[model samples]
Target: MKGKLRPVGSPVPFPRISERQELPWAALYHTEFMGSGTEALSLAVAIAIRRHSQVSTPEVIIPAYGCPDLVSAIIAQGAKPVLVDLLPNGPHMNDVGVRGATTPSTVAVVGVGFLGIPERLEELSGICREHNLLLIEDSAQCFPPASASKPHADLVVLSFGRGKPINLMGGGALLVRTDLAGQAEEAVAQYPVSVLKVGMKWLIKRLLFNLLMRRLPYYVLERMPLLGIGETSFHRLDTISRLDLPESVLQAGLRDFQRRPLIHQRYDTELAGLEAWGWKCLASDRSEMSRNDPQQPVPLLRYPVLAPSKDMRDRALAVLNSEGIGASAFYGRTLPQIEGVEAAVGGRDYPVASDFASRLLTLPTHEGVTSADVTLIGRILFSVAES
Candidate 1:
């Protein structure tokens, strides 16, 4: 692990030229690809706003702790983002908090699947039905995603960014249910299609990106402060365009979906004794929408764990990074603490989300992570806890 620097996640490798299969989800829902997950979310929120136009000032409920892009999506549609606390030490929203936050103006509830852990969409859907609110499943971090003969949520958002489950460099998808197909399709038709131009420039850029992903080059790049390797910042989403996907991108995503489960298994087995060290794995037996499906377990974008305390979490993070393992405290702060988002979410105290953020740390589980990396990560955690 001397000269190598593993990134927190790796992009899906470029696929070999081959016969392309039709994107699988297309058969399941009315799907539309877009420029980014943020754009896809913006469009979904827009549709919800229009459908609930009777509300004078529309509001959308979201978990207090998540990507600032959540706020960006809601605000882009001129809707207020009502932040709700998460279930204690959990990735999903607290049921009571979500219910308490709802009001006459609330138009939708965004359920985020954090680090590939699906939210309890079945229960949330029941809650939404009672209130006549739209339910949006943000599956940006999930793999082996939820789908059915019928749509699971009113809208489902998927991302194909650098660190996402299916990294296509940059793209996202919005799946609209049959009920909302008219509005969703109408909004989609307004944007010009973004056809990825695969040429010398694209080839060179792709090659360079793959090269930088290597340990030594990434180690050097990680030291460059201006690069801001792991910083989380918010950018206002202004445009939404449909993506014209190529067969290669689809093939690559398929390969990624098929390969990630083994990596997840390795991490789970290697990190088995975490509780003995006072650390806890977050991948517990939480119920989700896919509970009844034959495919019971799914791969997480990263394997997350909670340290006994924030001090121990910080120390273990340093040790993991020093050993060249890609470890991170994902979104180290709640949305309101992020610079550009405070005005939107205001200065509310989300005690649960704050505690969750402080103790959280995630390990790499992508295709690039080796067995030795998992072993080393476990050893380091044990060492830190024992200290």
Candidate 2:
């Protein structure tokens, strides 16, 4: 019998983005966000502080269990990241976010769309003005026109990375306000282009996963565990590894978007059953409800649940991945624990941050996870709960 084939994953090209095409803004600011959107957004934060006349280091708020790269980005720019807890039930910046944003040192706020769960963007806009800080919305994981959530911050960054609702394996766009446009373009011009590998990896994924992944073996290929190649997919802006991208990548994205375009809707109809599946969603906190009366339905990211024990998350993620569906402790644990973040907060874990981190487990959803897959995962989680 022939030995099993190694699970050859998607290749490198600039990945598809929120739209099938490149962002119109990318033509304006052509830097590829190395590795993660956090890097790019943080860079925007650094740029925002440079405009301030005061020499005081800026303060920024990052959701407690989010991208550690984000915290590092803040520090690199001579700023402090004030950690905020997630909204109790989901990956959202909530009242805790508001509280964290209140500090006088806050020069900006970073918005993360956790697991594709879109945060309230408009609220961040208000937070920015009240504190006179720049609002740098990180739509890294979520696709957006930033419609309902509108914070006319000084700047914003969106990614075209894999697993992001729009699958652009390698690039992102930086959006600065009209006044700062010229300044941004000049500064970005100083930044280097994307690496060939980065572009190649993304292009491969788009062709492989988006275009042809469905045609391959549904089980044998997708479920091949341990055919694993150790690789760092996300490029940290902290290093000098920033790659100069070919203009063609940007042009491809812009053109594709105009052709197919990404549109955001509430959770998929098939996944609607999930809302009642004991997945306690983090709706807006009471304070948010009272203020602005944000009337729009919040975007649900992963169906996160409190694990029965410290080990449940790992066990669950392993099971889901083995079954060939994406699963993550996603945030892993509280930011205070990460080597990078520990340095930032001086190593103290707040109750909300610690508990939320420990208890949370996220499961992937989409029209992607089949009925059988959902049933399988639901059963496993339910079994874990019962056990």
TM-score of each model, paired residue for residue: 0.94, 0.69
Pick the lDDT winner. Answer: 1
Most accurate candidate by TM-score: 1
Model 2 — TM-score against the truth?
Answer: 0.69
What tens digits encode model 1's per-residue C-alpha lDDT throughout 134-245? 9999988875456442356899999988888787788898888866788676667777888987667776777888788878888888889999988999888887788987
lDDT of each: 0.81, 0.54
Stretches of model 2 off by over 4 angstroms after superposition: 1-36, 94-97, 145-151, 183-186, 193-236, 239-278, 281-324, 366-368
For candidate 1, give the lDDT. Answer: 0.81
lDDT string, candidate 2, 64-133, tens digits: 7676767767776677778777665556667645764566666677776655455676677776776676
